[model samples]
Target: MPKVIAQIYPSLGGTSEMSRHRPIGRDPYAFHTVMHGLRQIAQAMDELGYWGLSHVEHHFHSEGVEVSPDPGLWNLYLGQYTKRLRHGQFGYVLPARDPLRLAEEIAMIDHMLEGRLFVGVARGYQSRWVDVLGQRIGVRASSPGDRAGERRNKELFFEHFRIMKLAWEKDLLQYRSRHYEVPFPFESGIADWPAAGLTREFGVPGEVDDDGALRGVSVVPSPFQDPHPPLFQPFSQSRTTVAWAARNGLIPITTFAPIETAGWFAGLYRDEAARAGRDYALGQNMGLVRSFSIHRSRSAAQDAIERYEMLAWREWYGSFGHLGGFRFPGEEGQVPRPGEDVAARLQQVGLIIGGTVDDVKRQLDVQLSAVPFEYLVWHLPYAVMPLGETLDQLELFAHEVMPEFGMTPPEPPRLRVPESSRERPETRASEG
Candidate 1:
């Protein structure tokens, strides 16, 4: 049976309705509501038997879309409210962060969650935040078109990724690369007299040399999970990334690819893993991320997609060229015109599944049969859906859809409310 993970995109609800407030991302009350809704989702998913709950890491969203800036903190906060559900980010944009700090934070979070943590890293695509945060390191965000920027970003991403893994797996760490040196001066090391004796006596061996120079650093309180928690790379579309992930034993979550593309990537990953001496079935170490809307009627499901998802694509993701992912193999260069019904296009390719229980089940059956993916990530658009509606969809899928795939929850869902009270008034209007 496949593990189901809920990927939360924390958009501040009702941004379109609150024009006077403009960017609801800055509204404390709205932010509070989103945080509370996250808690509610976490608690509910724990009961619904979700394997994990994940969030995204983005910043400076004054327009109130994808406002989850600190996913690690969110994981620590939500971990307290649920026992069974693992918490993590779909990913942290690695090029924009100091990998050592990220490693330490993740380790602490892992301990706090009592081994219920996973780590995800990404080569960032958003310049709005990434360029600003990465300015200190002279790093810039890149997309497929920016060849030079993309290469630089990949270099930083790969270097940072290795450093984090070393911190988790090794007792003492010393690293050097084009962008970073662990001890600042790699050759000389830190010549500090303070705490040298204490560290030599108490810390891991070789942390300080005989002459009292700090030779290596130790990332304290190693992860609660053995060695470290599972690592993941999200929205993995390229063949290069799949091969790298396979070699490193990191699960690659395919979000934008169509089933045919995803299946090809899965096979590539399997072959690469075998070459790396880690043999696996076609989709055993892979995940697929999909948006879903389960409703009583197919049209109603389509309506939900238009209301909750299309606006975001039109205003945000489309501008970033992400909507192109919905294009079929031959239509890779096609771009949607203004006012195009992108929701329908997405559905035509089966990128976003929608319909009644049976319809959703059938669509999933077809898609899953193609790849046999081991993990299914439910990408929830929390900004547009009310807490009640989101819960309703989760419950519907957990009870009706998951069983067909052999995913049985330990306990029945316990958060069903009367239909009349499900839509909170503040979130009734769709976000712009």
Candidate 2:
């Protein structure tokens, strides 16, 4: 059976931080700090025996979130720090990045992790980001994410993904597409020697197109995992995304309204997979504790939760938001800020966990037993709490509550695997 592969993205900001292309902090090291802390967290998780950690990718976040443009660096950093902790990126927004460059970097990370990396790919959604990349969201902006600019970005994504796969799997690569093409011939003297067997499987190697150009092409250091690390699509709460993933055999990470809601969506995804004749063996972590409070003590937690309620009201329910006065983080044209119906706003998205770690655990289990999510990530914004406080909550969760959830920190690379074998493919593959 595929063990549950859950990703915990301890973002600096929460949903509230999502605004017009703004990130939580201006300091460049915001992401770096998170990466450093993640190693510690991963170390703890390994000690406690947890499974995986995934980082979020966003161009702009509301208040306390960190957007990682160069996630490859973080991946490498974490990969070097922990031995067996599975690392994931909840996707690199396709159009906002250079596909080929991203492909090489992603391949390197895969090699570094010995294939423990799972990729989540999506078309850039926010208008702010799309614009930054010089893409347009025009009339489609009104439609939901998948519908707006969906076709172009998805096409670009698939095109890039296919190309990346070809580059990684093939020896001398030849690609000719409308927008991109590269041909390599046999005489290019490309040195391709990866320690991992999976690298050879990723592409078909032969230099030169019919034009007979020297094949100097090779993806350096093939992926560390076998075959290839999976490609997960962000579930858009749409059958389109789900069915597409099901048909294509993609793993998925999605959000649920609450515990019961999570179970329902997971069942939907599983059913779609089954119906599509795809492997049900693929794992899913579709639970999200969005904009929730995790506090060192009950009082702080309660106060934060109340503030979240207020935030929900201020952002979504209040009249200022409703009449189309404002726009979503990635929207153009303009939308009303929102109307105030604080309770209804809270009702819009449920806060399933609030009280204590134990309280959170009980609620989480109730949802997990039904939906069986492989991972659950929390969205603890920086609005109400300080970063230090958030860290305490994270530490506490790692030390106290994670054990109940059957998760513990990973062992150091040396203890987890023989140091001599760290350079060996056998060691990395087995770790996965």
Candidate 3:
């Protein structure tokens, strides 16, 4: 059985009822509310047999959607609240931050979670985010469409990733890449003279021999997991990156594409793994994300779907829906321009799985039969629904839908009925 994960975007709801083109207003109270919701949802997942909780990292949003700038911090806060369910960034944008810091933080987080943190990385796709981070870090602002910009970003991503892994693998960080140069001398330990003199002054513990050669200074707090935790990268249409990830043993996760497209990527990964001499199984390191919501009846499911579509249309699709330009196998590879058919397109692609228990089971069966993956991450908590409703849906899905997949979700904690709502046996008999 494939592992089940859940994701919730901490959207600050505003202007969803207004024009889709209009900018959304941020509600100051949303932070507390969303965090509360996350805590509740995460705790429920921990008890209900979810494999993990994944959140997206984003920044500089005036639209009041996707405000999580630091998924690591969120994971930390959630780690304190959750027990067994793992937490991951659906991923951390590699080009936006320092690699050394990224590696260290993740290492510490793994220790914090006792090796439950799934490290997901990405070279971000948003131009605004990339430009902002670039300018902040004194790099030239680059647009998403600019070839030079994209090349620079990819280079930085690969270079930084190399340095990060080195930091985890070696006792000391020693890296010299085209993009970065670390001058810390290490020969069994730090080398003597200029480098050793500076490093010793900083209270690094290493003995200087008669030959004045320093020895045994290492990077602090190695990862809890041997070598490092599992590395994951978001799947993309770029065959080069996808193949590279497969060859390098990083898990590839994807969403917003049809089953055929997902399977094609899986096949591509398997082929690349074979070339690299790695024995890769079809579904072992692959994850697919899909929207899911379940209700008691078809009418309720349709109503929820309508609400979800309206919210997604005004807030999500209206904002970054253009990023879903990924093409499926047997389809024209042209990126479809966003139009009035957004909802229909999403439905046709099987992105949204909102229905009754039976309906959801059939939909999931069709999807899994077409494209099998090791993990299925449900995009949960549509902002249009109340926290209660979302929680109810989660419980329903856990009990009803999960069983079909051979996953037995534990019974959720029952809510205590209020004394006022409790009926006495005598009163019930008289009423009857």
Candidate 4:
């Protein structure tokens, strides 16, 4: 059986704002309440033998749906409180930030966790994040009328990722791409001109040398894991991206899509890995994230899920309604259209695994039987559920559902990179 992980999209009392129909009841310390609740959830998952916990990164949201700006920061905070549970970013939007800084941060966090960090990178989905960053980063200005902003996003994502990989594996890094010119001069002569190295030319006080350009730059403190930490791509709906991830040795993660849709994407990854002459293990790499709730009765579970759907799914489906889903029971060969009923959309998408223990167990059995997945990340601590109920739900999952699947918290992977040697260069100065 694969590991069962917990996934959280932390809320800061904003659920009420997203929908009045299922408003989050007033709490004076909603922000503090959510943080405390998350800590408890992390502690419980650690004690209850959960494989790990993963967080999502979202920003500029007034709706309070997702309050996490940097999932890595949250992962670091939770790492201190948990004993053995791994921490993951379910993901970070690659095109929106500096990948080199991200790599260094990830390496630091991985070391803090003793090499238990799992990284998931994505080309961002939200228009607000991508467009705003595109303008701020001058991508939108440079590439006018390109895929309405998607072309630059994909290009930047790949370019940044390429540099990040080099930062991890290379001793000295310099690269050139259509999008970026890394370490501009391509070589730093500090080794030869130890006294005067580009320091005077750039007007910075240092080991002075005009010959040294912005070159020989490397992400110091290389990752604790050999080569790099485990890399994952959170959204696998795109066949092109799935194939790319597989070829580049990244685990592809899928959720909210139909079972068949996820299965197809996973299949594409496997095929690509095979073509690349790499052995692909479903239990080690393939991940499926699903929203779930197990209750005393099926009707009780359904009612609770419906309330949550109003708060979350309505907005989600309304915004991303073009995806294949939205059908009545037994309805086949129907294409999804926008503005469909949220309940129908949820059902069609197989978005929730809510019901009694037996009901959820059955759903898991069916899905697992079809997809030889290795990781099952349960979306929990939903906004509609009170903190107490959410904790109970996680405990219930740990005790009842995980056992049925023969799941257990996995042992921490043995680190392959030399830890002490990497830390020795912590104070090494370099170019911007």
The best candidate by TM-score is 1
Model 4: lDDT of residue 21: 26
Residues 289-379 of candidate 2: C-alpha lDDT, one tens digit per residue: 3334456566766677665445533553243233231222244563322444443334333433566777666665665555556556554
lDDT of 4 by residue, 168-193 (tens): 98866667766655564334533444
Cα lDDT tens digits, model 1, 240-276, are 9999999999999997768888888899999999999
How does each model score on lDDT? Answer: 0.85, 0.54, 0.71, 0.72
Candidate 2 lDDT at 229 equals: 67
Q: Residues 1-432, candidate 3, lDDT per residue (tens digit)? A: 678877766665534522453444255555677678888988988887788888877787667567688999988899888777788887888777888888889989988887778888887776667677876554433345577877787787787788788878876455665566554344343344555555555534444433446554345566777778778887455578779888888888876687877778888988998898887777668888777768778777767766655565445655664535435566664445545355556666777786778888898899887777888888764454667877887788787888778864323222234354476665888999
Clashes of each: 0, 60, 0, 5
- Where in model 2 is the C-alpha error above 4 Å? 1-24, 28-46, 60-64, 134-148, 172-177, 182-205, 209-211, 214-217, 281-299, 306-352, 382-387, 408-432
Q: What is the C-alpha RMSD of each candidate to the true structure, in Å?
A: 11.3, 8.5, 12.9, 6.1
TM-score of 3: 0.82
Q: Report clash pairs, candidate 1.
A: none
Residue-level error in angstroms, candidate 3, position 222: 1.3
Which is the better candidate, 2 or 3, if ranked by TM-score?
3
Off by over 4 Å in 1: 18-20, 330-340, 409-432
